[model samples]
Every structure is written in C-alpha cells, then in structure tokens.
Target: MDVWDLNLRHLLAVARIVEFGTVSAAATAVNLSQPAVTQALSRLEGQIGMPLFDRRHDGMVPTVAALLLAPRIDAAMARMSSPYVTMSRLRALLALADVGSYAGASHVTGLSVPSIHRAVADLGTAMRRKLVERRGRAVALTEAGVQVVNAFRLAKVELETGLSEVAALNGQETRSIAVGAMPLSRARILPRAVTHFIRRYPMVKLGIAEGARPELVEPLRHGALDMMIGALRDPLLEEDLVQIPLFDDVPAVIARAGHPLAGTAPDRRELARYGWVVPPRGTPLRESFERHFAEVGIEMPKVPIESGSVMTLREILIDSDFLTLLSPDQVSVELEAGWLIQLGALPPELGRTIGLTCRASWRPTEVQRAFIEELAEASAGLPGALHPDLSPLLG
Candidate 1:
C-alpha cells in the first residue's frame, strides 16, 4: 500500500500507543481523547490489513506488525522535525519540488494543478516560510524549501522501509534498494553482485543508477539512493557518510590494441607524450593519473577530453592516440575483446581504494543487508584483491 494513503496523525497515535502500552496514555501524549486514539488505532489497523494491538485487560499488547512499524514511525517523525506538517502538505510539496512545475507535478501525482498549488501554499503558511519560488518557466525551492524537502525525503524513506519490513515479515517482498554506481562498479563487481542477489532473492527489486560521484552523492545524502560503489576518497570529509574499502583497484594505462605502445612498457613520460582523455580532475582515477606523472618528475599530460563515461573513453581510445588511466575492472570486457589494451600499469601506490559508500545512519533491512554482503563477496572475487574476503565488518 502507498504510505500516502495512511494518515500522519494516526500513525503517530499508533506509535505512541506502542510506547505507552495503553490507548489512554497514548491519547494523553498526543492530546487526543482516549476514544479518539482507540478509533484511530482501529482505522489504522484496518488500513494496514493487520492487527496493530491486541486489546487486553492489562494494557494494549502490540502485535508483531506494530513492533516493526513503531521505530520506523518514530525515526520518520523525528526527521520531519515538525508536528504541524500533514501528510497532504508533505506529499504535495515533494511532488512539486521534484517535478519543478505545476503541470509536471500534476502529471506525476494525478492531482489537479490547483490542488498542488493550494497544498504548497498551505505548507508554506504552516511553516511560516516561502517554500517555493518561480524560476523563469519552472519552480525552484528556496533554502527553506530545500531543507523541508530533504527532511521529508528522509522521512519518506524511513516510513517506506518500515512498511516494507512489516510486509517482509508476512512473506511479501515489496521493498527495493537503489544503488548509485560509478563507472568502475558497473563493469564487473556490481553486475556480479546484482546477478547473485537476484538469484537468491528474486522477488526483491533493485534499481541501479549510473553516474559520477559528484552526481550521485547528493541523492545518497537525501535518501534517494541506498548506497554507492566506486573509488574511495581519503579522509572522506562528510560526517554523515561512511565508506567501506572492499578492494584496491589497480590503475591501468590503457590505449587501443594496435597503438605504438600496445606491447611495450612505457615510462610515465612516454605515455604522457600522447594527448589524454581522462575523467575530470576531482575523480579518483583522474587524481591517480595526475600523481603517476607529477610524482615521478614528469609533466602531466593535457586532458583535452574529460568525461566519466567508459563508452566515450573506449571509442576515443579505439580510434585515436588518446590514452587514459582506468581500473582494469572498468574496461575488462574491452580488454578481453581486444578493442583496447593496457600499455602499462601504474605504480601500486597510485591504485585506488574502491568500495562502498552509504549514509552512516542507514539501518538496512534483511534484503538490503544481504545485498551489501553480496557486494563484499563480489569484491573479494575480483582479480588481485588484497583480501580473500572482505565481509568481516558484516560478520
């Protein structure tokens, strides 16, 4: 069931009932009459298609479903950070904020344009802040609006996860994990992990979003993505995210198969002579490339084309003299097909620490945790992995 179908206040009442173990106490906490709380509990239980509490002479005894949902409701409510916000207002603004236009939001939500407008206005008035503003032909969130949307996004994730957890307990697989994949992960490890995961849990849905680190990080922070897999950053600056190093990806100096340096071991200077096409400066691969040259007393090659696309790099390397540094894992298929070949390998020091990144506060459900374990197993099987297995943290 869509979480939006449930009432925010009813969910809160159920959570309070779980906490206080009695309808009367829950009603007192939420400022509702005891009868109102009891009625709301009944309505919520009916909507959920399960009993949330067993009415008893001693006190309300929470069912298994209620125990599963209570903490999720508590976390979601905490993230929302406002008691006055209703489900209607949150849904309306999120649709508008994500779509950027009334027409787009209406198309997505199936709500009338007027209704979307009214809901957004209502949310702004309730918060006492302008949440949205016009930007040429579309709408944009003001700073206040962005903050509200982020909190709501996280709260939505929490609520959905809670519902899905309860469903899983009932033998229904209704949850999905969204993973942001950098280019390197897309090549071998991620596909392998996904295939194995699907074999084990065929009913669970998985969405893989391919993008550069810069493109993926914000979505991960906002709960749009469950995790990201790629090169690790040293001294990762973000306090809200944690990185797990699964393997060291050796940097390969790659070029077309028939190039002059194809079968030869070239020094950094020799490789630097040809123009380069590498990822933009900030990425781990790009940084490794910079280090390989400058650290050894050679000038860094000029990168005429900068991109995070393997397809673009492959095509450029195939037909031109442009060389690039990449993980062999990223171009294993091309290497096998002889469309591209590695001319030389960078020093081991220049290799990247590749692994997983996820929000520090994320609490994975059963399937989600299994996917992470699968990733560790896949990384261990990759060629030249430092460790035979990398799931000690999970264990």
Candidate 2:
C-alpha cells in the first residue's frame, strides 16, 4: 500500500474508531462531528483500497485488513504526536519565559508555580535575556520574547532529531546489557560512562540496576544481568562465574569525628566494645568482618544496627557513635567533611577486590567494553596497585 497517500488526520480517525468501537465515540475524542469522522475514515479506506470496519448492528468491528493496518496507523499517529509534544513543551517553556513569575505560569500550565518560576529563571540565565517584565503581581513578555521563542523552536527541532537518532540506535540491538553495581558506584562512576557510551553508539542501551553483592550475583548467574561491579564475595566467586579483578579496596572502620575512636587505633578487643553497624549477616562484607575477627582470636561484636543501604550507613556513622567497615571510596566525602574518621584499616588480606563478574559464557558488548575502559581509566588514577589487564584498558 502507498502509505505516503495517507494523512495524519485520516490515520487518527481510524485509530480512534478502532479504539472506541464507534464513529460517534471517535468523533467525540477528536472533538469533531460524527459525520466528519466518517468522512475521514472513508477517505482513509479509499487510499488503502480496503474496508477497515465491518458495519454491525451493535458497533463497528475491525476487519482483518483493519487489524493489520491498526499497528501502522497507530505508529503513524505516535510519530505525528512527536511534533505536537515538542511544541507543547516549548509552549510551556515560553509561557514561563513570558511571566517571570513561575507561580503565574504554573497556574496557566498546571505545573507547580515554583517549578515554572525556576524554569523561567534558568531559561533567562541560559539565554541571557530579560524575557519577562515583572510589574508587581502582573507579568508580561519583553520585546525579546519573539526571538527567544524562535530560538526555542529551532532547539526543539534539534532535540527531536537527536531523540529520533537515539531511538533508532536502541532499536538496532536485539539484546541489551544489564549492569548491576552498588548504589555508591552507580552515583559516582556509572553516569559519565553511560553518557559517553550512549553518545558514541545510541543503538546499544545499557540497563543499569543497583543492589548489594548478594542481590546482584544471582541476577548475573541467571542471565538477568550482563555483568556486575561491586565487592566480589568469596561465595559468589566460587560460583560458575568469571571474575575480572578491577581494584582492591581496603575496608576501614568509620565513625563520626567526635566519636571516642576517631583518632585512636583500637585493638581487636577494644573494637568489640562499641556498638557495630553491620550489613546483613550473609553479605560478603559481614562475612569478611567476622572471618577477620576470628583470625585475630577476637569474638565478633553483636551488631546493634543492620542495613544494606550505603547512604543510610553513611548517615548513621555521621550522626552516631556506631562504627561500620566501609570501602574507602564510600566514606571519602564524610572523611573530607570531618564528619567521619577512619579509625584503622583492616588487615591487608582483608581488603576486598572490587571487580567485574559475569557468567563464564557471557560476552561483553562494545558499549560494555568502552564502559569498562572508562572504569579502568578512573581506577588507574587512584594511588594503588592496578590489575594487569586493567592497565591496557586505562591506556
């Protein structure tokens, strides 16, 4: 069929009729009269050279041709909606630019007044224009309003093209890479790597999920995740997975600055005197901590608090006397702020290797490889021993 002969209005009418099951309902949806909707449908069917609906006493039912055409017509409608969506967004931004008062724009656009105000303020800063004139409670657009709107229109077009390019890229890949990491790593490392990867090859989409080691390992084995980066627990390493060591991170006992152990190097026995903040018992970190204590001929302290969230652990350490063992990277900010102090490091062998773990059969995609490269670069900049394979990736 010659799809070029079909117009958006005709497609929309057909889609609505198919959805609502009646010409009258379709007309109501499009704010057109029933006769106008029927005319559009008639025009559409004429172009396609097939009757789309089988007229029934109860309601119009879609024929085989109609069912086949429905998906194409729906896709056409979605494509047409893209321009309108951009226009609507630009209009909202323009409305904010006109009224320096976000509250006023919010009332007009049904957005929070402060949000409208912030958008206007940000746009003004970005454009270096006084787009709005504020006279008491009233707001008005300045002479620059026309120029700003025109520029925004051009920007909207560019954005739409960029989005289309990205969408096209994602559709090219039959499979996607699922990456799992600790939340801290997600915040600090993943964003830049993801951005770089997406920009270079828009077709490969990375599905990123964050969880603790215990939660991430099963997903990696079950083929739910392509690979994971976090502390590789001994049990997880023992499984049928290949571990590529990234870097070794020394575990340190962290506590608030004013805590009694802040400047003191507490012996293993003294370490057991305080309340401990530990991860759930089954976690690699918890197991490592227990094993280390046992090796030193000391009893493991009963943990007073248990949590898996790094942020929660950080906050608890900052505000309370409770001490917890954490990767140095996790507590770097707190250490810099004087909110936390590292009492002492774990024994050298107690340091865990943060690495990439994947099923032995799993193959890394180009995007994943690039991300791993970026990670290696970041790791190499740190003052520590680097894994041999990581050196080449860093270069």
lDDT of 1 at 42: 83
Residue 184 lDDT, candidate 2, scale 0-100: 44
Model 2 misplacement above 4 A: 1-176, 187-192, 195-199, 235-239, 388-395
- Please write out the lDDT profile of model 2 over residues 141-172, one tens digit for every residue: 77875556544543333232222332333343
Candidate 1 lDDT (Cα, 0 to 1): 0.87
Indicate the residue-level lDDT of 334 in model 1: 94
Q: List the residue pairs that clash in candidate 1.
A: none
lDDT of 2: 0.65
For model 1, residues 1-395, the per-residue Cα lDDT tens digits are: 79898888889999999999998889888889998888888887777778988989999999899998999999999988877778888888999988899999989888899999999998788789899999999999999999999989999999999999888777777989999998888886899999999999999999999999999999999999999998889979999898888888778888998998877888877888999998887788888888888887877788889987989989999999889888776788899999999887888888888888988878777788899988888888776565534243354
Q: In terms of lDDT, which candidate is strongest?
A: 1
List candidate 1 stretches off by more than 4 Å. Answer: 103-107, 110-114, 383-395
Each model's TM-score, in the order given? 0.93, 0.51
The TM-score leader among the candidates is 1
